[model samples]
Target: MASGDEPSGELASSLRAIGARYQELSQFPTVTHAALGAGHATSAGGQTFPLYTECSQPDLARRRRLRFSRHYSVHRSPGSAVSVSRAALSAEIHHQLLGQLSPTGQHRAVLTRCPGLGHELLEVWGSTGRSCSVDLTALGKHGEVYKEGPFACLTWSHAEKQLLYVAEKSQPRPQPLFSWDAPGAARPAEEEEEEKGEQFLYHEDWGEALSTCSMPVLCVLDIEESSVTVLEGVPEDVSPGQALWSPDDSGVVFVGWWHAPFRLGLSACSNRRSGIFYLDLSNGRCELLSAEHRAACSPRLSPDGRRLLYLEGAVGGPHRQCLQLRMITWHTRLTATVLDVVQEPTDAFAGIYTDALPPQCWAADSRRALLSTPQRSRTDLLLVDTEAATVMNLTAGLPEGCWVLLTTQWDLLVATCSAPHQPPSLVVGVLPPAGQELTLHWVRAEDAPPVPGVSWKTLTVQVPCGEQSPPPCGTRAFEAVLLSPPAGAALHPLVVCPHGGPHSVFDARWRPTTAALCQLGFAVLMVNYRGSLGFGQAGIDSLLSRVGEQDVTDTQLAAERALESEPLDRRRVALLGGSHGAFIALHLLARHPEHYQACAVRSPVTNLATLLGTSDIPDWRYAALGLPYSFERVPRAEDLAAMLLRSPIAQAPRVRAPVLLCVGARDRRVCPTQALEFYRVLRARGVPVRLLWYPEGNHALSGVETEADVFGNCARWIIRHLGQPCRAAPGQHSP
Candidate 1:
């Protein structure tokens, strides 16, 4: 029977029965598109044509082509026949002309004139594998002068029909490329004389003026004349990372507190409130914009250039709320109004609520916006109409996971959907004229490997809470997806996978881990506990202070319901999670140790106290746990205490499962020390625990190479401690 059609209890039984079948099917060899063939147009000489092919050709050809009309036309004289002899024209036509005229001919042509500025290299590739490069320097006065990577911030200036490039200095010194402008230029005699007089007046002045420190510098470049001017000494309080120019390009808006008149420390005012300042280019004058207690970011200019739009708050601090978008008018005064506000819903999903993820972007007209609302297991994208105060869910049925939406002309929407089992892909849709039906275009089916002999089925389970009736509380049924391995004679191991985000929801998608586990003969059950985002605010609000309790019960119930339908070895089950999911894993071991034999946690928040105190973004903890930054002023310590009661550190002594903890050393979100401290407590209690630390990683380990390592390590550890010898070695396959 298909698991999707079965009740939650029956679904689990079906999965156990097929475990062996899944394992057997997983051993077969898999095939993927490896290469494409070269062009096939015949040359004039009748020789087998060879146009251009980078790699080896595939055994079979599968071509998808698109063509459009060219806009070139010719005019002929009136009353005169313009027909020319085809033979004569063909003989005279050279290969170059033929290549240029041939619609199917492959030839590379220069696309952009600029070259060697703005990172010195810009490569663009089309879907058809055609690539073009542009050197910004070659564009003369039009080229960009400077570029910064990792974030791709760039700066350039034009003067006298010439473009000048300003690039950040590389490594050790790490200074902004102000030298790109006025390179090798000397100061005027009057300035030199004034500097000398100042030097004589004060020794400190001489040292300060002569010293050159590496910092973010703004340069003015003239591409036509090939000149550079280095504007070195910026205000001391200006943070380079937050420095940007005004919309009219007349001044720079610098955020931070200045220490000396010119030496700015990036980390100095990071924790404190920052002010905005405007620097005039004409007279080299600096003026304070506002003394507001907020860090400003993402400054955008209104279409009419009358106002400025920017997000204000410390980059990662407790005081950080998605500060309202304020429109600063240029009347030399700042009056602010909140463009977006959080709406409190009466029917919040199960009474669950969190400030919805701030709207990502505003529509071109500034009237509509996109917001992400994440429940415990899923996330939903909402289209907010500011005019009507109405919100429409754009991605209604997408499974629980992170998604991003991009708007095009006429409000056409494109989004990328992702989940544990599903690779991210672009989904395009057109909103109807009346905004009724959304026509989705399936450009391409996702290319994902099947789960060998196993198949996934969704089941509806009545999640029971002690306070509720036996049939379960609130919503009568919660949907859960179960993956059963191939047919097996004996009971197989079970793995309960709880998604990250106590407020996130789960969705259906292809997952490599799910495939691997099924191949290894384990039945996997994924649960969408309360507080997950998809079902709306109420669903997410339900799991607020109930994380360890409600979420754990949901996961346990899903697993037990699965077992009821299938014969399984209950003692062989395990739990696995990463991030918030990791918190769930630890919670399982602490509160229900007897249910699972082992657990794996990746970048888990072990101690709620440390999470609140040490996390780079203090606002996240404050919002999630409803805690105040200052202990002396905390109003709801009792509620905060109740939430912290589920901290894994507090329950370390009671956990009996062998544990594996993974952390990224440089993780700013969830401090690496949290995992270290938890490991310390667990190890001291004589509970089996192991820790893996990546020195140069962040909160997410999604880069391909790193992900491979993470998955491989997880698989190896699970197999090793679970007393399971590999039925087949890694990379071994059947014909």
Candidate 2:
């Protein structure tokens, strides 16, 4: 045996440092936290339960989940309406969660797990309304959830004893920084003065891309044994997402994603294809359902096993208002049902739902269904009459700021409700039977944090119509909400905010940042531009191929219209946005240079042409740049040329507004290189620009401390650029 007589303390120190880094990476599990319980009216002895999860942060860096169960008895109304407020509700966020009641209502099952993050554990519970406590520690590798897959979720079996979920087996390992085997001839360099420094091309596309070696598989965890079984027959090439067992638990239906020879970066794009696949448990064979030439996801099987409901759309497509949620007959005994919506709406399916929409209990006839939708910039419950082929708004009388999170057993609705001056509160409302009117029973959570005093009102901004003539294309109108601080001696600075997705909307939901800004004496105009959802198809269609141009005009006109009514300082106006919202902010400042003073953007898309090659949503450039996106191929040179012309980078030289860029170093959807390039260009030109780097941040740049830094800097930056920071109490406006 050979031995080193002398100890090398230096080598030991280096080895320990590497081990510490590995441990830190391992601890970053994709864990979701939660708290609270929701309930609804239920039948005698046979009741339904709504489980709530809360993330209790003992430290800014670590999080844990706590579960709550509140039962609503069908025989009686629990209490007089329990009124909940908004400011108190917005602080709760949980990871992918599933909650339901057992057949006898004697027990309930709640499952919660975090996605994309590593080392986090899934929290499971079996409660009986009175007592249910199971220690979830010291579980072996069979129960661990890691970070390599495209998606993961936790659900309960029909019997409520076994847990079924989508799991990815391959553990992600650290890859080498660069490939070392390549050898190429060097080109002769021109004099630095003669050459324009060869524009620094970018190649940061893969940071957010899925690892090639990883794939998703369906797995079942036995609650009693704590052992796992990877389902057989799942293809190596197909990665599955969000799945559910058939009503009888005889089959598993899930979303299947097949990769092409070439991969797109993380920015969600319409060109990627997905379909619904079903695995017959008896035979262990997987078969493709409909969804060809369409991206399908979030499949739900009716309890009676008579029908299936799922969403079909170009998820990242420009048709902001066109995603559809359709229902198909599921009688295998008869012929396979054709693709069709049991009830199709005149307007495109809208609101925030793919997987977020909770499956409601089937009507007594087992035909009609209940669900929530985003309509007219507000979240509402819609009861779908499958046979009648019509949709009804159950909560039509609810206030404007009402946003539904998800529904629970026996028609219990969980939502966030608020009015201009009211802070958001956790709302628990009961839905009356079909023919009767709907009323809400709410609960006011104690020890809730206070929201800043702010008042809001709805307003519409009108922009010019058609092209050449007086009646070529009609004028379009957009709706927005004006949020303001208490009246002061002088008018406050106006900050125009835009929503991302380019296709998304700025709805009545309570935004903590918006309230914070109002507290600092600012008037905020949140624009629901032409491309926003909730409007009719005509409104969303107007922005199809007119992204940079039409969206820019809409934002500018909305800002001008808002200033007309609000008492805001015209000279002290500022612009803010993230993602595509940031794209609009930058272009507005460049095209109409004097329209705003300073601009602040987080993860803004600077160059569309560059993004075509480096962004996770590679096809996004083609679609947003006015060309149809091809599912399997990257855009050609001509398509890229058009993108370059439409990007904000083309007008960067015209921007005179001082700019601040916030970036996440670990973002996969939109890389940080875009910001680096923008920062470099501005610095080189001697323009006023600042860049803030979040070393371990992702696309949102979020964390307890990181978010505070990002939003705090945002408000402070605007105040500094606008004029002065005022700190007088409400009604004590600065003189």
| Candidate 2 TM-score versus the reference | 0.77
Error of 1 at 123 (Å): 11
Per-residue lDDT over 56-165 for candidate 2, one digit per residue giving the tens place of the 0 to 100 score? 23122442232223222222245333333322332444553444444434444544453553333444444523233222222322334423333555656777666666
Model 1 weakest 10-residue run by lDDT: 93-102
TM-score per prediction, in order, is 0.55, 0.77
What are the lDDT scores of the predictions, listed in order?
Answer: 0.48, 0.59
The digit string of per-residue lDDT tens for model 1 on 64-86 reads: 11111111111112321111111
Give the Cα error of residue 640 in candidate 1, in Å: 13
> How far off is residue 573 in model 2, in Å?
0.4
